[model samples]
Target: MTKPLISTERVQSSTGPMVIASVLNSPSERTSAPHRHARGQLLGARRGLLTVAAADHHWVVPATHAVWIPPDCVHGLRSHGPFHGWSVYVAAPACVDLPGQPCIIAISGLLREAVDRAATWGEGPMDQRQERIAQLLLDEIAVLPAEPLGLPLPLDPRLRRISQALADDLADNRSLAEWAQWAGLSGRTLARRFVSETGFSFSQWRQRARLLRALELLAADVPVTTIALQLGYDNVSAFIAMFRRALGVTPGRYFIAAS
Candidate 1:
């Protein structure tokens, strides 16, 4: 069964320290329901993949990346398998300069080491030296570059239906014309609306959706051939090519580099 990594009550309480940090090193799967708290969060895994879902987008975070959740932003999380991660929570009052929207940021060694040091301080108010470290954490967060690891969902009901269907089954190989007909939209309308609403063409969106799922499955140690076939690729080489094009590495090397 999935487990909570930290005390929800403690993290949500308004009376705690300005910054609270926690670490999770678990063999079991972990998940959290969609919920919002009063703190901005920097969440990353060191040995697994995490999928974070907000109301309008999905993010696939590998070990080299972390998701920044602004204070009070509703989100949920699921780990692919055993997870080793750290989370740094900043009180809402301290979040004014943080990113206004949730995003995936590249994790630097300095940020990871600093968070590890802070995780030992417990939930109490920081001492002077700890306060200085906390400031370093905040400074690192402010400057880390955001990555292209998010999938934006469409607001239009018709496009949402299409997106949900694709998410449910990335292997579905229906063409745009067929999907438009099924959704009661013209092909041109579907193409144009997809670009405007999600900033991606229908083909681009579908490819991205498949890539994200591939990452999730790969994290679970699924075989490349199985994942390629499951994701609607006719041949393993095609899938590998696509994966390399998007991530600059093959599936195997990707996880190896992360490790």
Candidate 2:
């Protein structure tokens, strides 16, 4: 069973150009509200999923990915099932090379272990060996790529209503015309407005909303075929193709990487 949100003050209060690992077990809870840290944070789940949202963007994190949240970024996390994760915090000035904007970053083996080990350290400057590892971690992060894996929310109420409906059920394969009717606008007007406000056409945005829900189900060990059908895919292969296109790998491979 999950417990209440874990207190993060220990990691929050640490000093220096430091890296502190905060571990989370499976079936975890959520932060009390939107909050910020003075230092940058890399939030990753090694064994489960974490839903993180900030600045109108939301990411559903399977174990394969982590999010880079810049210093003072207001964000929050929610976990529904089991997971083993870490919150790796780095002091501000030192986090310069890392992204200032929130991003979804794929984690490599060395970086993951570095964070796992850092969880055991104290608040002072690292020893030579520790310093070496810290440098390597930063070097890896500097070159690491970011994934466009988040679903962005729109400020417009019409778009917001559609987003909410899709969040409740990703299987709604509504077309532009259908959505426009619901929004009380014509199809052409709705299409243009959606792209202008959300940077995604109605179809693209709906697909991402669906994919985000699929990710949560996938992390829970739900079968891919079932997820495909549940999300309104024509068949398993089609869903796999879409998943690969969005994630650069097939669903099975993606979940394996997460594991």
Candidate 3:
């Protein structure tokens, strides 16, 4: 079957900005390799989960949360399942107040509607209005709160092993102590090193990792029970509770709203 998750198109807008629009067709079985973009990008996932990577940072932007990528940052986007969204690219000058860091920002109802409207506005007499809308877009964009979404993995072979292992198996169910055993270091020493290197506690790193994977699974519409099991949760309610605690809403509500 054709890959239905990523259909890419580029267009020019009256606001003197370039727009790249795409409808994600479906999720791939394997992980997405890393990549980037040229212009500043405003990205949202109308359905499913979108994993966007930039250098050491990554953001798992769900439908409720959109990511504003500054110009020229190397980034990567991976879809969990059938996903769709628009990617608006603004020139450097038009992107003032846009973030330099990878972040997840809440897409308010107004902003979301504005984006959908902007998608249909073509060049011509609409330039002035488009410019105003663009200005409003940038102004509101600056106020968006940022949230970091990935564990900072290191390049060291030993540390990299641990990172890769965690990504490969979120349900490994191994404690840091257990992991340290395989690394031939004391648990305390390993814990300190992991935190020092990644700037996140072992538990926090693990939680971020699980949330990242969970976002991907949830976007794919994988059964909640399956997602919970894959993420090492003992029950669906526990998984839902954790998701809600982290994102401030249930997964279902977020997905439906985005759609």
Candidate 4:
């Protein structure tokens, strides 16, 4: 959780569908609080991992991916490593073609160049050339494909506690009985309530937690073998198998395709 070199609040100014790009060097472990934007935004990181949490949905943005956030959706971010990124903001009226909800998008070379060219835009008025670039940026973003890599968070307090515990230590591989004991609940009650509240059993929830954590580590470009050991998988192949099961592609192929 190194302090973020750049803050979102530092670049909230956007006029007439502007693509405001910013470079964030390793951000703090957590955002100060949830914040909103007057206009819809597509936040893309040129490097590092960017995680966005809003309502029950949590999105993890790998270096080659971007996130589309609807206007007025209160969200927070947690960034890892030196993050170079862009925030393309569109006036609400201009957001008709944008995604209606939060989404993780794949960024192509063309879109990346468009964003890089527009990152220089500040609060100052855009000239005709800049205006044209903004329009083109929006057009490029509209065609990018979305990746279903989001982890849904549950609201129940008990389920929330489990999520928080896993977030603090991705390496934890404690037994379910031990976890329940720490929570001071009988195993049966814990097991039953887990599914009732989160619609996922404890084991399933743990797998998801590990899956999400793997993404952050992968975004940092950690070696797959190291990531496997760190996430409590027995070996590299095991980790790759799990990742493939969830994402439908091996880790290396996933990034290659995404990039």
Q: 104 in model 4: Cα distance from truth in Å? A: 2.6
List model 3 lDDT by residue over 70-106, tens digit each.
7766766655455466556666656555787666776
Which scores higher on TM-score, 2 or 3? 2
- Tens-place lDDT per residue, model 2, 1-259, is 2332224564355466466656766553444367776777788776544667765666556566788888878887765354567777777767888886888877788888888777777766789888877777777677789977765667678876776566555677878899889988789987888788778998888787667667756766889999999888989998999888988888878767665
Q: Name the runs in model 4 displaced over 4 angstroms.
A: 1-17, 44-51, 59-64, 79-86, 196-198, 212-221, 256-259
- Winning model by lDDT: 1
Write the residue-wise lDDT of candidate 1 on 1-259 in tens digits: 3555567786686567778888988887678888888788999887555767765667556666789999888998877667788899988877888888988887777898899999998656679999899899999999987778777777789987898777667799999999999999999999999999889999999998788778767866889999999899999999999999998999989877765
RMSD per prediction, one decimal? 5.0, 4.8, 5.9, 3.9
TM per candidate comes to 0.67, 0.70, 0.62, 0.76
* Order of the predicted models by TM-score, top scorer first: 4, 2, 1, 3
On a 0 to 100 scale, what is the lDDT of residue 140 in model 2?
A: 68
- lDDT tens digits, residue span 1-259, model 4: 3343334553343443355555443433435267776677777665545666764576545565678888888877765444555566677666778778788876767777777777666666789998888788778767776676554555656656666676556678888888878877778887888787666788887777677667656767888899889878888898898889988998877667655
Total backbone collisions for each predicted model: 0, 2, 7, 2
What 10-residue stretch in candidate 1 is worst by lDDT? 1-10
